[model samples]
Target: MTSAIGEPNAIAITFFLVFIVLSLGITVWASRKTRTAEHFYTAGKSVTAFQNGLALAGDYMSAASFLGIAGLVALSGFDGLIYSIGWLVGWPIVMFLIAEPLRNLGRYTFADVLAARLRQTPIRIAAAIGSLAVIAFYLIAQMVGAGNLIRLLFGLPYEAAVVIVGAVMLAYVLFGGMIATTWVQIIKAVLLLGGATLLALMVLSRFDFNPLALFAQASDMYGASVLSPGRQVSDPIDAVSLGLALMLGTAGLPHILMRFYTVPDARTARTSVGYATAFIGFFYLLTFVLGFGAMVLIGRDAITGIDAGGNMAAPLLAEAVGGTPFLGFISAVAFATILAVVAGLTLSGAATLSHDLWVSVVRGAKADQREQLVVARAATVLLAAVSILLGIAFKGQNVAYMVGLAFAIAASANFPALVLSIFWKRLTTAGAQSSMIVGTVSALLLIYLSPTIQVDILHNSGAWFPLRNPGIVSIPLSFVVAIGVSLLWPVASEARRFAELERQLHLGVESADELT
Candidate 1:
């Protein structure tokens, strides 16, 4: 499965290039249709319900979910299912609580929703900061993953792989905008599902098409413990921390939230989540088949030798079952998976800077469509540069946990603000601002003091914060702060405004202009 020293994988390279070229072509086509802030940020709000659902699934299911979770399953066995379950739980909550209100109230970003009822200035600033921070962490992790996966798949150097990812993703966002980004996600999701499905069938055919037989074989080879729990996480507190993060994180993810705006209305937004939930839940189940298949068929030694973290389990499984050709196809799908996700993240970050910060804050209501478009493109360039740099800086890092850190931050910072804005009425502008700022700062601070940082980065014997995931404490802490601030320092006018937001939330009434 390993390549000769520094040699290129021509099969993988050819497939990778083909996917990139095709995605760029889609970008060119989308660029012709892209105009105004609406087109750039929300794809002109014209995406159909089912299409937006597929795009949502594509955007939400990153390389971490595809490669990292399967690798985790291959490595930790039953404990890996915890990660899958935790991630899937968040979608139901999104479908029920957040998606509809977000679509009804917001035009572009989550900031649109929050700033709908509150004072625009502080809400925009706080939300913009939270969005950028989430995007920074999430984007860097995906870019780092892009570097590693490409290096392994196509034999590119880490820097070159990262740069290629950065350059291409920037094009998708800069020119084609949300239109190009949404299509790229849909294409990648289909390829990933197809590749995963075929790989699963190949594995299952070896054992009479019964998944239990595959598990039985894994249990026999690796011991019954592999089919049981408590391997990677034995501590209840730490497990809860990770669970809370995964369960609540999706509702807060800006790129995922931004997808709702691409669809026409609140009803469509809810329908898209229903579709995404089905697609994502099915994909996660397939990962179990793929991961267990890797365990029984490929064996631990070979899988570890390829990747210590087992991130290559899925691709290598394709190689094992269908040989080099299938391996090349699956690897290219992984590359596309990374590219589509980072494009979505970069677009969200650009919106934070251009839509929220530049047009809304700096230029105020007077900002023209042309100026907003120019700033968004400029922000994309700036974000792409930063993403490339961070990707290089964190070379060889475990991208799954890097993504987990992102989820923890999202759960802590963005979730509370968004949920409270929509659900709780007495939330003041100052209260929302403090909750966001506090939640963001607390998550980052606790993460730095956490064992993941203390032992891994700081080389310390003991961590100031014992948990790797901060959500057990941070998520509740954020809700408490937001609610506490709102009740204690009630703004009478904002509370009066709550009746209007309630109308939009319950009746699907369109929100009035943000700046007005």
Candidate 2:
């Protein structure tokens, strides 16, 4: 059954095989020094700013960004540009506001920042749950995307593709930990950017090196009447919801924030973010070319017949221009992208579970470094299994939609707490906990009842919820809840402790030996 799917080109298979081997080798080498919990969780605080920056890019540019944005632009024109813009704009907020502060306060996870001066148990447990939810949804989306891409490119059975991805990603996290994961991300980022650049050049060369000619050609191909700025958006509210989810959502992601902890200090963290922003912005601009290339070169009818979910736009374009070789290379790159992303998600989830939940909550601040490392590895395996099951369950769904939901949830539950904790002096732990709970619950409830899920998944004629994403509503609700609660219970002692921690985090002073 696995072999019955179309066979990938021999060159493509070889390239993919080599990537897998290289990634695994890096993981094995990284594991040599994984002797302490700090090493397993934070790479022993040894990762440089530039390397961490690349890793952050690798983590941020998931299959959703690489494939989904291209597909969206191919299908929805100007509406797709909205997604690209939203995603790209969020980084400035992350860099200027969140990055250095998060790095200064956090050692392992986002929870470390939020739970820093708070009572350990409740806040840690809540944060762990939020992190796990965000990671699981993200991992499943990537795994499902991997399976679908393998099926499309190699003609492999879905289960076989998923199992293969699961195995490789598990090996990445289990053996390599943060060090291996970072290097794998850097390698994947380089390959992804290189591939996009080559494809973009090929696409531009088709228009005889004229940028205006490319857009003009795309408009003509799409028909001049539908090429207007707002033509693709059928519903204004849905468009706004989508934008809010992509923009705010990027700032809130746990895996992305965790990358800051890998670097040495606040200055390095800021520099890393600047590099990431420039790289990501450039790649998104390239996506516009690729999307329009598909529209003109491949045509909508051909692409729809070839790809049900539209993820095939970029790969199909590769095949059309460069034939079997480019197709194979693109396929291999897509596979690598999925593997790197899932590994990062698994590692983030594991850290939240082990460091935040088990070590902080269950062990009651008494567990040694060795004991914590063991817990983290165990949690990694458990999260991997959970993600595999989810991948299988949501097999044929659009990967972009699932990823969007994860982003929405992350933005709602985590973003407010993180922002307020750093900037607002009166933010109590109770406020933080309430914000997480409210944001998470509201977003999940809204999503479950949304038209996309309620009507589409449940086969209902009417939707209980109107919005496809809850970020616009739920994110604000979380902020309000946190502020309201904090105002009511603004204790002076907690405020003083929080202020001191903020000063320490901003100053980069190391006080607690227990902290990494």
Candidate 3:
């Protein structure tokens, strides 16, 4: 997929530098406006619904979506489309179940909503840990993708590329916080959609603007099996498990959930979700065109000859169809995708670290905005270092698979507690904490025992856990653990407030905001 591996594409590298310079320019502009913790965390809650929608879509569609899914579809056909379907299906659930209530309830972070009535310290600790776990896995995945893609496009060293990504993301989050991050995401989203539109058009024009013709050509070249489900999800249980994680995980992603608070009100939050759903769903559909186009137009042998993972398919397709100039544009868009996503993830980690753990938990909410802002930037730097190290360590791994694991963990650790705390009258502080702890531990343990970590990473043939995804087990267990623990010893104070929380969940800011 990467024909110019050792040979640097000067045009692509030039465009890459251009995008980086422009993005850093955004950071500088945003820093002028970023002042308090509110600005740092939620962009002063000034983002309009449509803008936040674009930012949400941008932050959500990372290198994993653009490159990883396209490559998967290029290589595995119908099986790769499953990832797109699963990823997009989650948006509606997030809109109906999470967006409005989450925005109204949480001022900055989702942990605020989860810990609203519960004991702040315990809930914050548990929620912080859960948020951090998701961010850690996701950051590494994006960083790994960044490293590989940069090396492929620019001929840069993998470790150096990862560090460059880390450093740039840190600068964005540290100085401009959510404001810079949001603009970066919005810009990236626009560029990605635009670039993908052009690429898809170029691919479709070759087949007389007929998708079926493209598929027919692909079938002629690859065979009928290429249009059918393949080895990626041979196990029905694994498929269901993965679907569960993707559908539920959107409710839990810290960065995505945090976007809700970027808007002004619950109604705006709802509006943002609608816009985001449309944009994200549209983007997912275009990926099919890009993926199938790569297969039929670029050919499998050429793709695999360059990068066996097929990650180079889209960029290579750009080069084949549009020459080095278009290749440069697409490469820049992919890099922008990685930069925007990693910056969003890093910001979420900072919010979780500083706002939830440091201010709310450690300082008992007495820490001022200035102090919190300081901590947030410090945390961003710390997270950046961690991301670089992990990205280097996880080089050559499948970015798509790593993202799937991240979704599973998010679905398990954060989704259940957030849902129950909002809707269940019987939910107690102990229940939420225990559920998060058990969900996180069980998910990590299952992954370590599963083929993903054991056989894939450790090269051990005998993995204790058969399925690569632990969501089907871990998600339900989280709900059960919460229920069981709450029933065993309910926190009457927290349980009693469920009536008000429930009222707020249904109403707009009047009820929900006042409940806090």
* Among all candidates shown, the one with the greatest lDDT: 3
**Candidate 2: clashing residue pairs, number:** 2
**1-516 per-residue lDDT for model 2 (tens digits):** 012114657867888999999999898899997778777877877888778777888888888888888887777666677778888988998987799888888788888887787766888877777777788788889989998888877878888889888888899898889988999999999999999999989888988977568778888877763245565446787777777878888888888988887777788889999889988999888888888888777777767676667788888888788777887888789888999999998898888888888888888867998888888899988988888888889888888888888989888888888899888889888999999999889989999999889888888998888878788889889999999999999878888988778677788765335453
TM-score of 1: 0.97
Ranking of candidates on lDDT, top first: 3, 1, 2
Please give the TM-score that candidate 3 achieves against the real structure. 0.97
Model 1 lDDT per residue over 1-516, tens place: 453312466677788888888989999999999988789998998899888988998998899999988888998899988898899999999988899888888878898888888999899999888888888889888998989888877777889999999999998999999999999999988888888889999999999999999999999999999888865788789998889999998988999999998987888888889999999999999988988999988887888897888888888888888878888888888989999999999999999898888888888857888888999999999999999999999887878877898898888889999998988889998888988988888989999899888998779999988888888888888888998888888899998898866877666655334323
- Please identify model 1 stretches exceeding 4 Å from their true place: 1-7, 510-516
Each candidate structure's TM-score, on Cα atoms with residue i matched to residue i, is 0.97, 0.96, 0.97
Give the range of the ten consecutive residues with the poorest summed lDDT in model 2.
Answer: 1-10
lDDT of each: 0.87, 0.83, 0.88
- lDDT for residue 255 in candidate 3, whole number 0-100: 95
Model 2 residue 221 CA deviation in Å: 1.6
